[model samples]
Target: MSAPETIAVAMSGGVDSSAVAALLREQGHTLVGLTLQLWNQRRLAGHEGMPESVQGRCCSIDDVYDARRVAEHLGIPYYLVNQEERFENEVVKPFVSEYLAGRTPIPCTLCNNHLKFDALLITARQIGADRIATGHYARNHYDEARGRWILSRPADRSKDQTYFLFGLTQDQLAHTLFPLGEMTKPVVRQMAADAGLALAKKPDSQEICFIPGGDYSAFLAAYLEDVGEEQPDLSGELVSTAGEVLGKHAGIHTVTVGQRKGLGLTSPNPLYVLQIHPESHAVTVGSEAELMGTELYADRLNWISIAELTEPIRVEAKIRHRHEPAWATLSPAGEGLAHVVFDEPQRAITPGQSAIFFQGDEVVGGGWIVNRNS
Candidate 1:
């Protein structure tokens, strides 16, 4: 209970976040834990009537209790901040729409941009926190000579999370801290065990926070209240890029880029959904070879490398978070639009998905893909 430098750490009741809270305390920093309560999308599935326990999910009711328990164990003030409105607008809504539009939505990236980093960082400033820390497996370094923040990977390459964090702004980076980034998962768990923490040996949650049963289509049908949210009755035919009708589809949302199964159509060769035309409500199916695309256009660009975009920059392009970085040349299209041509063709470069850019391991910038060569 001694006076210490105030630092707010986001505690998700997970192994990593719990380790972060414990480490900050060891550093003699006054820790205040903040956990954002996001809407649970899994409730739309079979567990609809069963009360959600935060024990397994980040947004679940049981998770709040677990987070609070960790905070109390660490003897730090903990709070659950309701971010349901923002989460709905920024993450869940877009998630359902992207699927409905026949694209894969990366909810982790949305949560990073909207809830975890932006909203919570702003809240930290309001509460006069010196820094806001998280359990992300990404390292940050201040380039003393250039006087800028740099993002890099943690010791664990498999668990590295720099890709999901490309949307983080420089301002957000300035006030952020990652205590466990310097150590691998094993090391982190060891730290937690040494501190007598409860989640020292807990397995990481693998499923998306919102998709409990991993059946995305079913969850969307129940959560999305849009007039057409329920399976869209597509009166159009499923055609190939060569104008060949392969089959018929109920809705475009039921399929996504890079998808190949459950098409309900018999074919001599395996079929894959290459693209979706929302206007025509047509889900385009083609051979796997046709799914490759080299060039793409993106808008709503966010640059994290420096102050301004003076000219077309060369960096690694990412079709989505978790994808390996690939070399690309990007040119701005006046406003926020960006033209990115990858050195090599990437698979399923679908529209309505993000294409983040990185310089080496550090994320430089990114945007929403408006077009793809596919």
Candidate 2:
């Protein structure tokens, strides 16, 4: 008889991941529960406008305790690897910088790209595990005819996490497993209960693990203070679409494209933030109609299901996570860049967000949005 393959399960101390560990254990696979201590929840606590304490969020002390208990209950070896330095350098710093530069960034995607898959996979291999399984709702398979690995949407569409996972490379896809891809959230919770796991009813973490209260502006102020760096003065003029200076503003970092509230201007016709110019710190305000855009350019491209984009392809492009897939024509603009023109004008094509291309259920490729053309 063949020996069982050793698998390392990335346990986030949540029901989905805990259930994954249980499912793999029942199949007789040698399981090792692993959790990456990516951030210290108390690092910024007590700072002005920051929370006094945080619990039940990702990387909190409570999560670590829960993960350890689950490993003990499952009778498997477990390890909590500290990767705080890497997480801050790769995810947190860039997140702050992106926001300061008049862009909105998704740190979860950065964490998955740099830490969870890259660093954790290295740790898994060092421990003699052949593959690392995560609770992410996505799927991947090797296509024999194409001689490449393909990532696709999961069976549970509502729980699909392929948007943040678009940066996954072919090699990473080959070495990783998504055990919860075929299961819905309700079914996974039931599996956790059946396995006797205690956290079956635990609520999912919603906010960015590092940012408490979902207040980016407050976090930015606290983080800058912590680093002993003075906040850059980004205050300038608020202008209209016709280059008419309306009033003085505080800073560029406090606003984003398509922001309607907090402009501090009382206009009878209602105004929205149309653009943010970081160089001159000029914020342009206009009507809601000005926020619509037709074309966008994305760089830092990563291709999946194909080696590289050699020609223009018709695909559905999602500008943001909650955005519906829109019909678009994607073409190679330059080296490591893609140009997308939506059939219908899309609103708020924010920079620093990801643009994931899809053809049916398959992930064609994705990249970072640098700018958009009206």
Candidate 3:
């Protein structure tokens, strides 16, 4: 028999990753469990509106303990790499900045693109591991005919995390592994039980690792105060689509597109946040119909199925994670930009969110949504 393949598993102390480590070890592979200490749960604790205890959230001390326990159960080496500084600079700062700019940002995508796939890959290599495996529900295969690594949606469409992973480059995909791509959540948990892993029944973490209670508004306030910075002067007038002043808003950072509640205005018709202008700090409120738009321009393009997008192509464009993919025509607008016109108008196509284009299950490319045609 030949030697086992050396693989490093990114253990999140969850059933999925624990099961992955056990399955690889069962295949006689040399396993090393690595858990990135992405954020300090106690950093913002005791701050106003911030949770004092962060036990159930992702990347907390409890999670690290669970990961270590799993590593010990498999008798594999485990290490917790402290990447708080890098994570803050790469993910947290950008999240706060994006929200302050009146845009809804996906920090998980930034964490995956900038930290997990990039920095973690480097760390895996440094430890003499051949490849890094994650618990993400996505798959990638090298297309010999196309000469590029093609990222595709996983078998479990319900657990598909491809939307946040659209920024993966060819090189990153080459070195990454998704063991849970084909396995359902239940099957993964059962596999962990078979492997004698204690976290087989552990609940999956649904909140962002850093933000306790999933309150971004409170987090923004506490985070900015912690950094000795004052919240931006976002006080402005709440205007209608026709430039009719409705009322005054506290700030642009306090609201998001498509939000219907907490507008502090009483009218016969319900008003929703249609737009937010960071420059003038004007919050636009209108009916839900005003939120729909057919065309959106995206910047910061990263192509996966092809080397570069040079012409118009038909694809399903997903504006946000939960939004359903809609048929659209994606064409090159200019340098580092793509124009997408959907067959149906999408609601709340906000900026700072990724626009992932898909051709069937395969991701063609994606970019940051910069603006929408009004």
Candidate 4:
């Protein structure tokens, strides 16, 4: 028999990733545990409303220690790779920019696309490992008929992470493995316990790794202060759907589409943010019914199951991580762009979020949502 493969596992110090390390070790593969130190939780602590102390988040010092302990327990070589500069440039900077442009951004997807898969893959290869495994609940395989790598949803739908992984290229899929794809969260926790991992019952990290308290406004202020940058004055008018000015706002960066609260408006009927215009810095508010839309445009496309999108195709599109896949007609609008029209009006097709296309369990491709007016 050939010798076992030397696989580098991305251990995030969570139950899922630690369980992955244990499983691979049990299977007799040479494992190198790698934890990317993407953020310093204390960098902006106690600044601009940020909490002085934070815990239970990814990339924190505690997570690195936990990951190191797991590697030691599994008797595998572990390395904490520092990629803070790259993370800041690729994920944090873009996150702040997107918000400043009057759009909401998903930093987790940015991290997965730029750091976890892309940067970590390069680091893995530099260390003599041919393949890297992650705790993402997504499955991928090579399709002999289509001659392309296929990424699909995992067995545990609730834990599915394919939405964030839509940007993974075929090359990345070929060199990566998702061992927890077929296992549920409960089963993974059990496996960690069986392997004598101390963090078997550790809670999953929910908020953005760099942001504490899940407060985007505060994080933006704190990040700007930390970097010695002034917050841009994006303050503008809040207009009604028919072009009537309702009121003035502090800044567009503080609001998002589909938000109903903190508008500082007191009307007999409730109002919601229908759209945000970055050029004019105008936030448009209207009734909740106005939030529904049938069409959206997405750019920065990445195709997986198929080589490229040439013709209009029927797909179940997911506009957000928590959104159920809705029936939509996806068509190539221009080079590296797609136009989607859902059969039913989906609520709040926000710019800067991803629109991931799917045919059943398989991820067809995905792109970043763009404002229709843009």
TM-score of each: 0.90, 0.97, 0.98, 0.98
lDDT of 1 by residue, 95-131 (tens): 8767766667778877897678887887787888978
lDDT of 4 by residue, 20-57 (tens): 99998998999999999888888888786888886877
lDDT for each candidate structure: 0.78, 0.90, 0.90, 0.91
What are the RMSD figures for all models against the true structure?
3.1, 1.5, 1.4, 1.5
lDDT of 3: 0.90
Give every collision pair in model 3.
Answer: none
Model 2 C-alpha lDDT per residue in residues 1-374, reported as the tens digit of each score: 13667999998898888999999999899999999999889989999999988885776888899999999999999999999999999999999999999888889988987778998789999999998999999999999999999999999999989999998988899988898899899999999999999999999988788898788888999999999989999899999999999987888888888888888898898898888888899999898888899999999889998898988999999988889989999999987889999999999888989999999999998999999787
Q: Which whole-number lDDT from 0 to 100 does residue 304 have in model 1?
A: 70
Error of 1 at 104 (Å): 2.5
Candidate 3 per-residue C-alpha lDDT over 201-272 given as tens digits, one digit per residue, 9 for 90 to 100: 888888999888778889999999999999878789999989999999888888988899989999999899
Deviating ranges (above 4 Å) for candidate 4: 1-3
Tell me the spans in candidate 3 whose CA falls farther than 4 Å from its real position.
1-3
By TM-score, how accurate is candidate 4?
A: 0.98
